[model samples]
Target: MSGIFKKIESLVEKGKEAHAKTWHNWAGNIVLEPELIFHPKSLNDLQEIVKKAKKHGKKIRCVSEGHSWSTLSVTKDYLVIVRDMHQIQVEKSEKYGWTITAEAGATIKQMDDKLRQHKPPLSFDSMTVLSSVRASGIVATGSHGAKCAGASISDQVVKLQIVTGDGELHVFSDENDPKEMSAARINLGLLGIMYKITWHVQPLFKLRMIDFQPPIKSWLYPATLKEFVEKSDSVEVFYWPFNESELDRNDDKLWVKQWLRTDDPITTSQAELGMERVCEDLETRFGDKLYQFIVKCPESTPYITNLLWKAGPVSKPQNVVIPAPDAIHYQSGIDNILCDDLEFTFKADKDFANVAEEFNHIVDSVYAYAKKGKFPMNLAAEMRILKASPSLLASGYDEDPNAIYCFIEVLAIRHTSGFEEFSAELATRWMKKYKARPHWAKAWEHVPGIKPYLREILGKRLETFESVRVKYDADKIFFDNKSLEEVFYGSPKSTFTESHL
Candidate 1:
């Protein structure tokens, strides 16, 4: 045997986590079988896998939960599952405050379970609704909470331990290595596999979640939306697009959800968390029959949308007060139906910004789609408020670091035929009209003009990220496939088909 082959073979045995397997993400939307899927149990185990992959001229991708809709985690050669590396060490300080250093594979749920056990307890300013997502996955992809007081999940990170393509473990922090830290904060799994994530946490606090179905006039008027967000700890609004025609209401209506820091204390559990009962009522009580009927002929989108609001438990107004974790999350309930989601962010510093304008246009398209016999969207469009971010890759581009931004999510239900094409049209318009950017984890990478839009908005920050990327993984050994290539390299193949636009 050749000397090089013998050396590579020896290194392969050192990577005990390696194995062959067929795998699918949690949502079952994406599936892939890698030649070898490695579940590293420790930092050393992870380093060994990287060393072997680099030696053998193989590519690697790290995945946890695989919640992202994009093909970012898809790879044929090597897949590294870091969940087994779960571990954590926490520290409290009089000067720096509470800091928790958790292995990348650890989950938000796990962190909350442990941190809340502290004498004073601790929690993140915001967190994704799905607690099962890994800390590494969410932070690396820039997952966010609905709170405007906090930045993307990545922004909470104070330090990171990463195993780069060359199998070296490097720790970078915002204070000491701002440039490197900026890139590592939202590393995109390109620099390397994250081994440990350290975050700054706040003292455990109580929050109240209130549900309001305000009249359409309230949401349509920019003044109301601004007040709702400015007064609440966090605010989210859901607009039922076909409401005017479907519900037979005088004007459109929105499910306005607001969360506020409360002295009310944690005093809720079971049969009353409210969300479970709400989803149940949605399926059984108020509008189940109507919703099911509309499902058969989604062309009657107005009916389905009406059924959604009617079925919801918040007929008048409802309130729930719970622990910080429970209050921050809800069932995202994204999977029950096959669908595609597209998200865009507008500046909206003090008010709706360009959103008020672009929103009107999209509403027009909703009517056009329905008029052309296109399926009407069955789910509510989600609106979230994001404060200015320190993470360079945050959708806002960090231009106005202190400015507030609003994230709007448009859901395209699969039950309705040709929703993907319609979504593509909406996403395309967002980038061109608002000069918006998509949340990294969702399905917006395919939108046309994405790279150019990001390039123009990000400016020097993009170049800095690219330079730091090259510094960490000079060979791009972690480059998994064409999907990753399209993002980092800006290749033409990574974009959506023009026809979809």
Candidate 2:
């Protein structure tokens, strides 16, 4: 499309990955064809690409593992795949304590494997359920685990190296500049292309994972759920509609998973864990086949979900002590089944009175809609309890570290009828009732009135992020996506100026 591609090709070891081939996201929901794509090997390669792009007035966007469900990583200009920059190192610093430093492209699994193999073993304070995502991308989207005392993954970032739109490398850390660090913690790739990252880690610990199916009416309330969360290091709740009874419409049971840090010896050895994974992989394959059939017959979702629950492990009870990493990443093989997810996070007060009501409302809404012959939600409604984060734009942002927050999401198989409308309805209600904020990396672009609502609620915080963003990329070279532009710049249209190289 332009001669600048020739100039940029001379700067990198590999000319380009693709010229104009179509690219799709992990879910195949968003697709685009960039004029040029590159997998730079080192910092110099990234710097050279950035400089050439800036000179040619082309925008740049870095993609991680392509797991994002939103358009945050979408760009038709210059796309960068950071897989080549994966290099991880474990460093012990007096000021920052023990940290795992790695290039921005390092996947969570790579880091987890390295930490587990260390002399004394090491692990992050919090981790996402999936380990295939890149570290930098995880932090940018504020992904998190269910640890009650732990915040989002972004909170664990101690240092970062980025190449700004000016084509200069800059390093920022909490020790040097907390204000700037706040912005860099979860900048959504607007500030620059992250080159490397340093994450806080701790001595590897064990967790006793226990699962129980309690009656929904008994432990699903605010007070009891509060006790459950307060007593556990990490807690997650899942409810599959029609799990208990389809005809009676009595989904009276809830599958609750809790993890508590313990001194107990590891009950599952590395070999055993590997074996378990193999078995689970087989199960996932079988489940995927069933899902394919259900996808063809969408109306059988409720019946199939009920059958799966009755036959699944959640129908029984189990407990085991395992390494923290193993427990944190509980399930795997999700890439086979594509789903649409909409997630939101809101602060829970000391007693969690409001959060409890809001959660109950979610369940009630599902049933209410179902009664009218609408089955917008067939998958599990998942919720996690996490501590607050200090990142300015994080969904769970709060001043107090001890503050409890609830991150809830509803998922549906891709192409499920009425999913978009259902999500929009819930998003609007949550925003108005609980002042909830949607997860940056999940589905939210189609939600009506979302842009104005975010602007109104995140007025000052958006300004703070914008101030720092301008300092790094004054010309807005990284602000090419319409979804992010709608939130920060109050524009729902692309401002990219096309120029032939």
Give the candidate number with the greatest lDDT.
Answer: 2
Off by over 4 Å in 1: 1-20, 241-250, 267-296, 313-316, 332-338, 414-416, 452-457, 491-501
Candidate 1 per-residue lDDT over residues 1-501, each given as its tens digit: 699998997676646545556877764667998888888888888888888888888889989877777777888888888888779877986755998889988977788888888877888878987777888999888888899676788988888999996799988886778989988888788889999998888898888889877666446566766667778998777776666465434466677778889988566774566666466435543343454456677766776675555645345465778777877865534434445577777677366656555555556666677777776566657878878777778775565677877788877553446666667677777665566778878876666556645555666777788898888888888877675554555642434335434
Most accurate candidate by TM-score? 2
Clashes of each: 1, 1
lDDT per residue (tens digit) for residues 1-501 in model 2: 478887676644356455546677888898988877878888988888888788889898888888889898788888888878889999898977789998989999999999988877999888988888887789788888888888888888999899998889999888788999999999899989999989989999899999988877767777898888889999988877777776344445888899989999888787877887777677767776776666677667768878878876564476889989999988766666788999998888788887777667767877787778777777778899888888999898888877778898898877778888988777777776667899988998887767767876777888998999999999888888987777776743422112200
Cα TM-score per model: 0.87, 0.93
TM-score of model 1 vs. true structure: 0.87
For every candidate, C-alpha RMSD to the true structure in Å? 4.1, 5.1
